[model samples]
Structures are given as C-alpha cells and as structure tokens.
Target chain A: MYYRALGFQKDYAWASHDDIPFSPPKIPLSQATVALVTTAVVDASIPKPVREANSYPIVDVPDHFDTSELSWDKETTHTKDRESYFPINDLRARELRQEFKALAPRFHFVPTEYSQRHTIETDAPLITRHCLEDAVDLAILIPL
Target chain B: MTARTLEAAGIATVVIGSALDILRTAGTPRVIFNDLPLGNPVGKPFDRDMQHRTVSAAFELLFSAEAPGAVKTLPHQWSTQDAWRENFMAVRAEDAATLEALGRATQATRLENKAKGLFRR
Candidate 1:
C-alpha cells in the first residue's frame, strides 16, 4: 500500500543512489546542537484544535481515538475541519520529546507551527528567537 | 528564515526533507537526502533502531555529498508508511478527544494557513 503511493517505479537504484547536500557540517553529533519539531498540531497552551469560529471546541472522543499508550494524542476527532493553525496536540509533543531524548540529547523542542514548506520570515522570527534563547545551535524538523 | 537566510546569518541548517521535487524546483541549496515519511521521517514512533539508521544515513549523505544538487537515498529495506494505523488502535479515549479537538478548531486552522502564506520556513 505504501509503496504504491510514493510511485517508486523509476529505479530501485534510488535506494543505493547516495547523493545529498552539505551545510551543517558532519561534525560529531555533540559538536552540533539539534532540535526536533513535528507537524502534529501540538501546542502546550491551547487544546488540540477541536473548536470552530461558531463552536465551543468541545473535548470529545472520536470513534477510533486512543490515548493511553503514550503521553500525547496525534489523531484528534474534535477539530472543526482540519484548520490552518499548527496542530501541536499533546500526543505529538509526547512523541517529539521521546525522539529528542533518543537521537539528540541536547535537542531542543521549538514551538510547533504549520506547514514547514510555507512559514513566513516575520512569523517565524518570534519562534526562532525563543529557540536561540534555549541555546539551540541547529534544528531538525519532522513534518507530519 | 529559509536555508538561504540561515546560511547568511552564519547559522547552518540541514533540511532533511522528503519533498525532493519541490526542493529541486525551487532551487534550494545545501539540502540533504532523507526520504523519511512526511511527519515521522525517522520511521514509526518509538522505533529507535530505525530512527538511528535514518539519522546515521542522513549524516553520511550530508558529509559525502559532492555538489549542491548531490543527493542520496538510504539502501535499507525502506517501505512506505501506513503501519501506524494498526498501532493507533491502542489510543485512549482522552487522546481521542485531543485528536478530535485538534481536527476541528477553525480559528487555529486559519492562523496556520496564514503562516504558510508568509514563508516556506
């Protein structure tokens, strides 16, 4: 099912095709500071996007919703219609912190945001400013 | 700031993205290969072993990459996503509430879209 979606019919050689770019030099993982932020609509302050302009943002359970296995919930059924706000839900945050602890001990968790492919310069400086405060040397973003 | 801005500021950034097509079209420079899934690139949540492999592979590509357009895809038995659905069956009711809430919020949705229009950060 997954293979069909990526349209991977070009050439199996792509797997062996090792060609990438360089910027954050391949220094020892420690020498380089790292951060991880996922696009799961997770936010520490507000509820995971379950309200609408005319709705009360009710907190209800969805048909297939699950919450006990981990610290946060990635799938939310309360959202009005998959809004434009960053879906920084509790579940995503939990998973993010887990990855941070695993991959990069010093990895910082920057505030969540929407579409990494689109965030504006002025809008992100505020978030980046705090990341700088946290002593973050670099960022490792995972878009969900 | 974009990779260009970060480089200009002397703060180096490594964009481990799956959108190679978009990156190529836009002519984004100094990027690396990481065909990890869109959100969970390093494989499914809690899969530590795979995560390590993905991160290690990314570093290799980053270090050995020849030129700006240099690219590399990991040789591990990579597969498409969708396994998460079965795992998600164990989610709790409270967590379900959270997902529901996040799915609906209208104002927040608008705000997110607005941010997208501003920058592809």
Candidate 2:
C-alpha cells in the first residue's frame, strides 16, 4: 500500500521467513528487566535528519521527540502526546506495580528503512547487543 | 525484524503495532495489534487509561503466548465506524506530484546515508 501510494513500480516486498525465532521468557514478569525499542528518531527535526539507529538513557528520554518527519497517518492522528506512542511513563507505573522488575537503563530508537537486510543484519544486532549489555530479559517494540 | 532478532538472541519480545498485515507476515514472535491510526498504536493520545490498557494487553500476550508468530487483536477501534481505514494513506490526485518529488528526495537521502555508513556498527 505504501509503495503504490509512493508511486513505486512494484509493491514493496516485505521480508518473510520460515524459521521464526522463539524464546520463552527466562524470568517471571514480576522479575524481568524490560527494554523499549521504537521507530521514533530521538531529538531529530526534519533538518537534523536521523537515518541511523541510536539509544538513549531512559531517564534522559525527552517528554516529546520529533515525529513530523516520519511517515504515518498524519491526517487522522498526531504524535503530540508522547505517551500515546513512547509510553515511558506508563511503563514506569507498571514497574511500580511490580508488573516488571525494572526498565532497562536505555531505550532504543531504530529508523524506518526499506532494506530488510540492513534491519536484520545491521540494526537488529546493534539493538540486541544493547539489550544484552543492559541485561534486558524482555523487550517491547512499539513502532509509529 | 528486531523482535525476531532479539528473540533469536535469547531475549523475549512483544510488539505493539497497528499494521496487522505487515506484522502478520513479518514472523514476529508475539504481537498486540491495535486497530487504531498508524501513529497511535498504543492508544489515543492523552488517553492515559487506554494507553495503560493497551500496554497491559501486550504484557498479557507476552506471558501467555506459547508459540512463535502469536498475534492478538485488541478490540479498540479508531472510531465508531471504519471510515479511517478508507482514507488511510490514500493518495490524492492533486498530491501525486508532491509525493513523487518527495519520494525521489527521500531515496537520494537514503543513498547518501548508506554511502556514509551511518548505520554500520
């Protein structure tokens, strides 16, 4: 749909795989360390231009990050409310409720790219390395 | 794709998204699909209760999903009717020219970024 809308000659080929990865939680939700990864670039405006993957300390996460440059359903909705997409506060409240043990020290920001190879081979490994370094037991991905 | 990679690397993962068709084929381990606008997947902006509920549901799927490729569709809707779906990313005839130019510029930027090795670890 997006490809056609963007005037591409053929529909974009979304990556598909037969050997889907599966890993059961190693720790109970009450004790697991959680991390967040989103498609929202951090502190980037249209002029600043973020075309790479990055991570920031969760405590340093902005109340709002720029999304005006990203592609989404801008007609019906807006990203003014950070909690609507980022949900750092909501996850913090959950941590207090003992829903999870703790939030990882850092949250990740991955750019939206057309190349699945870059995502699987480059970006994913970078995020996975960060998760391991933070000792994150579970990760929740929220893409805008 | 990151979820799949993370899970393969021994960390459990769950996705909260609004694009069902894309998520379905992406081979994600666990997903909570919200039938809302693209930008507001967790819930409507400023609606704290809805946002909390959506996150809670994603956690539920995380704990309960026994196999890979598990997906649960939340009952939330963007509106009373399905009008939003019809207009979602719908290209307008007048906007075609602008979109084409924007697309070309975006491709050029991507190529420049790639050459710079911006995403390489």
Candidate 1 interface RMS: 11.4
Error of 1 at B13 (Å): 1.9
Q: Which lDDT tens digits does candidate 1 get at residues B18-58? A: 55665555344444444443334444344455556556555
Interface root-mean-square deviation, candidate 2: 2.3
TM-score of 1: 0.45
Consecutive 10-residue window with the lowest summed lDDT within model 1 chain B: B1-10
Q: Which candidate gets the maximum DockQ versus the true structure?
A: 2
lDDT, residue B18, candidate 2: 93
- Model 1, chain A: how large is the TM-score? 0.33
Clashes of 2: 0
